[model samples]
Each structure stands twice: as C-alpha cells, then as structure tokens.
Target: AKYRINAFHELSERASQTYTTKQMTMEGVGEASRLGSKIINCKDVSYFWEGGCLLKEFSYNFQRFDKVEIVGRNGVGKSTFLDLLTGVLQPSSGVIERGESLVIGYYRQEGMDFTGDDTVLDIVGDTRLLGRFLFPHDMLNTRVSRLSGGEKRRLYLLTILMKNPNLLILDEPTNDLDIVTLNILEEYLKEYGGSLIIVSHDRHFLDRVVDHLLVFCGEGIVKDFIGSFSEYRSYMRDYESAKKKDSIASIKPQSSAKPEKKAEDKPRKLSFNQKRELESIESRLPELEEKKAAIEKDMNSGALPYDKLKEAAELFKQVSNEIDELETRWLELQN
Candidate 1:
C-alpha cells in the first residue's frame, strides 16, 4: 500500500537525524561570596559492601556549574556513589572534600521525610511553583496525608527545588512525575543556576538536561563520557562491534596461500552514532505516519473549505516526500 511505503520511508529518514548540542548562558547577578569553584573533590575513592567492591579508585574534582548524570544498571551502586558524594556514606579508602559554602539539596529515591496533617500550602508556601507541579489553587489546602502517592512525590520535589541550593543532587527524579510535570521540571532545570547531579533511568530526561555522563560499567569501572546518553550508547555499540570483528579475525585458520584482498573485501560496519540515528528514526516514523494519516483524513472530509483542503493536501504531500527520502536513506544504510 502507498501508506505503508510512506511509513517505511519516514522511518529511514528519522533514523538518520542527529541531535544538536544544547548551549545556554545566564547573566551573572550580584557579587556573592557564597559559592566556590570546587564543589566537591574525591581522591582514590573506593567503597565496599559485604566484602565485595562496589566502587574503586574513583577520583574526580567536581566543579561548579557541572550538569552530570550517573548511569548504570540497578544494584550497580549508583545510589551508593551519590551517598558518598553527599557525605551520607563515607568511602572505604579515599577522602571526599566538600566546599565550605556548599549548600546541597538532595532528593532521595526514598521520597521525602515530610509527614503529618500539614497542608500542601503549609509545606510549600509558593503557590505559583506548586501550580507548575500540578497542585492547583484548590489543592493547596489538601493535607499531606490526604494527598495521593504521586502528589506527595511532586510536593517533595518542589520542596527540594525551592531551597535554591548551589549543588542539586537528584536520585531517580522522574519516577513519580507525570509527562507535563516532567516538562515543567526539565524547563526549570534548564534555567537552573546550580550544579546538577542526577541518578535517573529516564533516557530522554537525561539527554535533555545533562551535559555529560558518568557511565558505570560494573566491577568498579566508570567511564566519564563527554556527551549525551544516546551518544554514549552509540559509542558502546561501535566499540562492541569492533571488538567482535577483531575476535572473528583472530579465530580463522591461517591459509598458507594468502588470497588476494579485493577493494570491496571488508564489509562496512555501522558506527554507534549511525545505529543511534536509525533507532531514533524507527521511534519517530510511527508518529510521522500518524500525522500523515490525520492530514489525509482532513483532506478527504468534504467539510473543509477550498483553502483548508489545499493546505491539508500540501501538508500531506510534504510528509509523503519526507517519508520517501527517509526510506531511500534507510535502504542505503541497510545495504
């Protein structure tokens, strides 16, 4: 079917798209001696649990204005790393130095400690900020004990942001947040004036906010990658592919008579970036098809005016062309 072909085309095109680097600058306001350049420093930091090493030889001088995300599989000591950074848990071997003026606002995965008959307004005085977190004016008087689990989490997150700490550490921040609230949080963090350190499984949130990644590859290995989560994933894919090819090369029986190498002998391998692009494309193609289908339906309906019908037709054409180009690219990538 024509619709199916267009869908495939769009998928290919979306897969090839790349992300642009996000850069933002804020104007400095007032002379304040309350902040330091070096936020935290750890030298040869290592932690052990149940006679097994969790983190080892981790040394980094965390600076002011650094947006970092800690990424690893569950039970890989990501939260423990955060605990060590915040002084909740001490490293077994190394020293962690905290800044004198450092005021840390930590949002734990276990949620907030606030409990009792206190109203939401009583807990968070800022009604404007509360509304952004989906707490309406009528909801302000709602008691903390009466609020739902999600509501309680949102209120807790708002409380942390309100502290205006110079160093903000969030563990699993996106867990209880709705999509709209998550958007509001992302926007707030984009303009936030502090150094942000987060431990979250939300890939989109990480890619949107953090500038770099601290990837934990089990057994006390941490790779400090200078890019988004998607980029890091792409790099890993490419690295693994190269290793695989090398492995295949090593096991082959050596021929006493070497065959002549042809120009097209080696098969081209997809780079991690390309693989990521294809993944993104596959994710977006369905959405694009939906848009196209909507446009077609609009055009087919007799209720549209001449101008409106023309507009819908034009849009449909544009989408079709895009799908076609993307499909071509996709095929090329496959080959």
Candidate 2:
C-alpha cells in the first residue's frame, strides 16, 4: 500500500518516440502453448518448510477451459500452492507437472515489481489500447510512478495480457479494483480463450468467471468440487446446518444434556402487527435484492464513468443495507 505513491514526470517528456505498438490476440494459442490442449496435473503434491509442512498431498487435474477457482479460509496455503504451480515454490514430496505448452500470466495480490521509471505510454506503446484501458491521452506522458494505486493495478493487468499467455493465474485480483473495473475484468475473463486459475473471495466474480473450485480442507487436504463459488458456499452452509441439526437431535432427550429455557425466556407467539411486518419484509427483501442484481448487471458492463459508477455503487450499497436490515428483522420476528 505504501509503495503505490504517484510521482510521474509532467509534459517535459517526449511522448512520440517513447511509445511502442503491441496488440492482444488469441491466434497463436495452439497446442504449442504451455497451456496447450491438456491438463496440468498435480499428483499428491505437498510442500514443507523449516517449521512445518505448508500443504500436503494436494492433487488437482486442471485443464484448459476448466476455469478453476480456489477457495479456503485464510492461512490455508491457497497462495502457497499457487506458488508451487507457478514454479516459485517446490513441493517436498509430490509432483506438479505442467502441460507441454504452458504460458502462465500470474497476478499476485500485492507488491508487483516495477523495474524502472517507464512512462505509461512507454509501458504500453499503443495509445489506442491504453485509451481503451481508461488511460487518457494526456496521462500517456505520465510516468508509471505517477499513476494511482488502482491505475497501476490496471496497467499491470495490461502488461500481463500483452504477453498473450495461455494460462492465467490471478490471486485476489478484486481486492483494490473498483466495482466498475471488477465488472469489466469479469467480462474479459468470460471471453478469454485461455485456461484460468483464480484465487479470490469475491463470490460474484467467482460465479461469473470460474466453473468449479479447488477447496482446501485443513491439514494439507484439497478437495476438487465442480461448481461456482456460490454453489460451494451453499453446499457448505447445508452441510454445517445438517451437522448442527444432527448434534441437536443426538442430545435432545438426554436429561442432563442441556439446560431448559426459563419460562419467561420461551419464544413468544408473533403478534398480529409483527406478523404483518414479517410478511412485508419477506416481500420487500426480494424486491431489494432484485434491484441490487439489476444495478450489478449494469455496473458489470463497465460502461459507466468513474463518478456514475460510484453513484450506482452507492445505490447498490443502500439496497444491500436495506435487505440486510429486513432479513435481520424477519429473523427476530420468527424467533
């Protein structure tokens, strides 16, 4: 966060000769690419360190068109395995084998290497493509050092795509990106003709970008499940809920299993007014959610300007707050 300070040079720099031309295309991404027409397999992969092993026996058969997303609670070594896949870290015991043609474009969560004082135009030679990416003509002469944090991240993405890698690995890419940019990135990922491996907590983005998940269970175990992030969350919720119900049922008839509620603490029957309010909330919450989804659909198009996007995002936030309040109240009434 501290390193993203902007300190670009002004109009004194030469703008014409500094810029070069590069184009993004998917033409040559054939079987020759590292992400060729096959899967990159991890066979019983495990990573060890001085203190302890980070991951154990993780295996996944990742293939092109897989659009895999990895999910787990923090400190589960999601990033560690990404490093192993990228060859940055080695597994103590298992194997991570890449396809014959694998060109990986990795975007880490933070701290990208900025080699030198390359201007915005210098980094991306063609001004038109830069413009498409929201870099203005005047800003083209600005140094990469002068760009804002979000601007720098967007530029980093540009550089990555310019490499035309067939395998894309993006780790927590939505962290600093605004909603507008996130939506745009989602669209790009949808149309990208490459294999994708993303590690993110943004459920909306994951649902749109990834087709399945690699869930990390603790103690170095990883489970490969076929579904979107939302689907996985729903599954986990159901599992936890069922487990809780089973636990409650197991001890239900035991005399000393649990203390009974005091007479005054018993749940009261809903009053007429409370019942009316509950029904109203149940109806209103769906409307609010539907409105939020519509706003999200428009924002995802990335057609709004910064100011308009912020306005729409604020409205979306308000809708979300309303839904949350209504749901909370509804639960209270039910109790």
Candidate 3:
C-alpha cells in the first residue's frame, strides 16, 4: 500500500508536468481547392472475414466535419469496418467511394513500431514540435524504448497529426494516454475541421468529442443515432427495461392460457440449485447495476486520479461482463 501511494504520487507529478507543457494542434490539408460535402460514401457495403459476415449492406454518407464514433462490444467488427472504410481491406460486396481531395490519417491500436535505439529527435525532426509534445531539447536524446507508455503514445499521436489529413480515423486512441494529453486532444478535436471517425471504449471521450454514433449492434447490424454516447446508453437502458416488462407481461398471459400439461409431457424444470442460483442472480442484479452506474459517473466526472481512472476502466469492463453473463443465464432460466 505504501508503494502504491508512492507510485500514485509519481504519476501525479508527471501529470502535472504534462499539463504545464506546451499544447499540440492538428490541421488537415486537402489537395483540391475545396473539399466535397460528402467526403466518403459507403454503398451497400458488406465485409466478410473468416467465413463470417462482419458487416452487411451498410450504407452511410460521411460528410466533411462529420464527427462519428463506432461503438460496440469486443470482437464485434468495429475495427474491421474502419479498415473497410480506409481501404486497408476490400469489401466482400458493394463499394466505398472516397472524395478525390480527401487525405486520410489512420491511428491504429497497435502503434507504430520504434527501434530501441531511435532517439526522440530522430522520430520527430522538429525541436519546436518536440517541445510542444513535452520533449524538450534536453530530452531529445531520450530513446524511444525508455519513454513511458504515455510518452510513446504522445509521440505517435504527433506523427499522425503531422500528416494533415482531411479524414482522421483513430482506433482506441485514448488507451494509455495521460489525462492532460487527453484533454488537449479533446480540445483540439472540438476545433478540428476535418471529418473524424473514432473507435474507442472511453465513454467520457466519446461523449465529449462526437456528435453522433454508429452503434455496432451484434450480428452484422449497426444503428445510427444522432446523440451523445451517454444519451444513447440511457435510451438503451429504457428500451431494454420496457422490452423486458413486455416480455414478462406476455409470459404471464401465456401461462394463464396454457392448460396444465401432463406430467410426462411437461418440459423438465430447473433443479433446486438452478432455481436458487437464479434467485440469487436476480437479487444481485440491481446492486451490480447500481455499482456500475456509480463507476460510470465517476468516469465521466473528470476528477478521479489518473491511477484510479485506469483501475476504474478495468473494473468497469469486468462488471459489465459479469452483468451480461448473469442476464444471459437469467433469461435461460426463465425460458
């Protein structure tokens, strides 16, 4: 516990330094005199991988200055769809058209590789830009291998911005970034003139930056919603709750209509242990949901310590997974 406290203090100090450091800016340069209103068009696009459909007949027009986020569970083809849009992968069917003047910049989750011996100056030739990124002249000789995770991510982000792309695609860009850097990025994006598409699990980041969302529901389905991430989440909660109530109401009516089946014809009932487990799950579900809500509130509050924020993010994932599992089992038992 003492070591943890010390580590937190060190992280806090680093964050303070990062905050006082000079800020970074991004600008997009297009080849044409002016960019088209529709920067990209996805015409009935479908992508299949490993014998399974990732996206099916997806059609959307991406316009200049459009800030869109793609969100879904893990392994739900969010990244794959981005790849299709960026031309890294061909669509299984249909087409993706890009504007002639569009210059796209992509930031992948697996960041650009750096040789251990490469110095910060070697990666970024401009000392002024290095200073803007918190790498002063004294630290120019610092090797990439020795830089902290946050530092390396900052460097990689600088590289992406240097390209001056009209369309920016970022995949999980918030991971391993310091809060100060994240703030700067959010501020820059708020003023950024380009078309932005982001794939990130950072709910707070999504709520702050994007105007609309392309929700990747499972099974090759995506829903477009014109609202912030928090609003979408709240809407889904209400929708699911209403649907569950309807299901329960319908089930009760069915039970009243159905005659009692013969002993041999009735389906086997849940064992005693299963029934107890189901009851236990039902009792715990509300408590878990409340805990999850609290965690989410803290995440969006922007007041949590940097170290605690990382812990909360991980815990949030675990709690969400547990809830999903329990809900699935509860539905099975009800059936």
Please give the range of 10 consecutive residues that has the lowest summed lDDT in model 3.
15-24
Alpha carbon deviation, residue 229, candidate 2 (Å): 1.2
lDDT, residue 17, candidate 3: 27
Q: How many clashing residue pairs, candidate 1?
A: 5
Put down candidate 3 lDDT per residue, 219-316, tens digits, no spaces: 67676666676666556445445654644444433444545533323334568998789779868877877887798789879999989998997887
lDDT score for candidate 3 against the true structure = 0.71
Better of 1 and 3 by lDDT: 3
Off by over 4 Å in 2: 1-34, 126-129, 136-138, 241-335
Tens digits of per-residue lDDT for model 2, 175-268: 6676667766877777677778898755555778776667666567565556776565456445445554644555546565335532223333
Clashing pairs for model 1 are: 9-327, 13-326, 14-281, 15-277, 15-281
180-255 in candidate 1: lDDT tens per residue? 5776788888877667899875555677889777767667766566677666655654655665575466444755
Candidates ranked by TM-score, best first? 1, 2, 3
When summed lDDT is taken over every stretch of 10 residues in candidate 2, the lowest stretch is 1-10
Q: Sort all candidates by lDDT, best to worst.
A: 3, 1, 2
Each model's lDDT comes to: 0.70, 0.67, 0.71
What clash count goes with each model? 5, 8, 0
